[model samples]
Target: MELELKKLSPEDGRDVYDLLQALPADENGFMNPANGLSYDQYRDWLRFAAACLEQVGVVDGKVPETIFWLYEDGRPIGMGKVRHLMTEALLEKGGNIGYAILPSARGRGLGKKFLALLASESKQLHAGRLLLTIQNHNQPSIRVALANGGRIERVTADRHYIWIDP
Candidate 1:
């Protein structure tokens, strides 16, 4: 399948909205601010997300983030995020990259490709080694990280801190 990575933008349509809806809620730390939003509200959230990339209106304690969509054959099937700078809290948990494949798209080797795509995106942002905080129980992600040259750097009660060369 043809694969492409695209930056998040206001021009995204219902596909992105549907993808966000399919993803877990932000309370789960998935960066899905558009969950449960009305279509118009989701549109607004798109602009807000762009503003976040510019460090224009990020909330206090939140780092500026760049969002990208992983598309297969021209349709979005996964999303990823890269925080511009690092923070202690981030290193301890959130890390530099966060990604999720559409539930329907899981187990198809897309997660590995998506992580690789995010790593390249991070390099473009001039980030050094990449950090990925994976849930302890998520074996697929743990494997994905490792496949992308990630090494287990630390282990917390509920998370595995991994580092991958960019």
Candidate 2:
């Protein structure tokens, strides 16, 4: 159950997209709430991911501080991201961390392992706590968060925001 995390590359875009497409219907795909993404929605998501990379100035031999890929047994299974506080809106609403495990990879402890790995990495980035926002209905994510020392910070109308402090 050892999972490896690697920095994402543009070459990985296709595999990531494919994994997202094959995500199981019961678990959250790229756009949580499961039911998976429509063909048009998937295209739009790819466009948006590309735009975000461009906006971060991380294209062409640059490393992104936020977005990264999560791999298991050399296969792409999910993505994890941590946005710095440079953007005030992200600090407040989006929080500092977010992750999505492909539905096909769920129930294998990959998500929990990813969360723990990121929480440990947060210390190097001067982050005392890692923030996670899960849809209220995502029981699996909530369990994963709690298993990784996440404590409930607040429960909004539609989401539960938890904090995993080091």
Candidate 3:
């Protein structure tokens, strides 16, 4: 199984669109920003995402973010995002990284692998530590985070604040 982690590209095709569409708009605490977008709308969203990744500096208090896709043998299997910088809002709830494996790709240790790949990508962007905020009930995600060397930094009424080192 040849696996690769690739940055999001506006030029990404229908396969990418299909993958995003497979995820629900909200799952546990993870949000699928691309859900419900029409094909053309999805492409437009990609353009916006690409710009966010390429922006040199934070604008209007919004930090830059880069999304990545995990591919296995050239087929997309997972997707994630790394926020280049953290704001108080991010620290509180947004987090520095968020990810989701294709529902059909769950189990088989893919979530752990995906998280690790995102961390590597974060390191490349000079993003220090990664903060992951998982809903309290999402044990699968919590395990994935822990397997990747994440430590529980805090706990809220409904969330687990984990920090994964770069």
Candidate 4:
């Protein structure tokens, strides 16, 4: 299936909520919400996500972030977050990009394609290089990063820091 990456928008609230609902709780730490949320709450969250692109709201003491939805034939199948600017704290942990494919859409190389799309977007934003960190056991993500020209820069106890030039 052909896939495309689209920035999150207000009109995508319902689709975004559905995508979130379709994800497993432990799929990706940042993409997972601890509890179920009503549509209204999810809409509010979407608003915040959109505002993050402008660095208007502060969440967890980070910079503004841009979120993108991966779509296949107009259907949301995955989501990714790109931090426009990286702070010291983010450099150490969060990295510049984060993404997760829906549970039903895994094992088809979508993850690699998602990161490649994010890399292109990052380049357009003037990001010289992108930082991606994945859990040590997340072989799938690691492979995705590596396949997208990501090099292992460092390794912490539970995370692997990969860098890719966009």
Per-candidate RMSD, Å: 1.9, 5.8, 1.1, 2.2
**Which prediction has more favorable lDDT, 1 or 4?**
1
Candidate 4 local Cα displacement, residue 58, angstroms: 7.8
After superposing candidate 3 on the true structure, give the runs of residues whose Cα lies further than 4 Å from its correct spot. Answer: none
Instruction: Write the residue-wise lDDT of candidate 1 on 1-166 in tens digits.
Output: 9999999998999988888888877633656767789999988899988888888333688888899999999889998998877878888778889888988988999999999989988888876888888888888889999999999888889999899988
lDDT against the true structure, per candidate, is: 0.86, 0.65, 0.90, 0.81
Pairs clashing in candidate 2?
none
lDDT for 64 (candidate 3): 90
TM-score of 4: 0.90
- Best of the candidates, TM-score: 3
- For the record, the alpha-carbon RMSD of candidate 2 to the native fold, in angstroms, is 5.8
Write model 2 residue lDDT over 1-166, tens digit each, in one string.
4477765454444566676666544434223321366656666655555455445433453323445668787788877766443344443455667677876677888888888877776676565667776778888888989999889988988678888885
- In lDDT terms, how accurate is model 1? 0.86
lDDT of 3 by residue, 11-97 (tens): 999989999999888887677889999999999999998999888777998899889999989999888889989988888887999
lDDT of 4: 0.81
Q: Lowest summed lDDT over 10 consecutive residues: which window, candidate 2?
A: 26-35
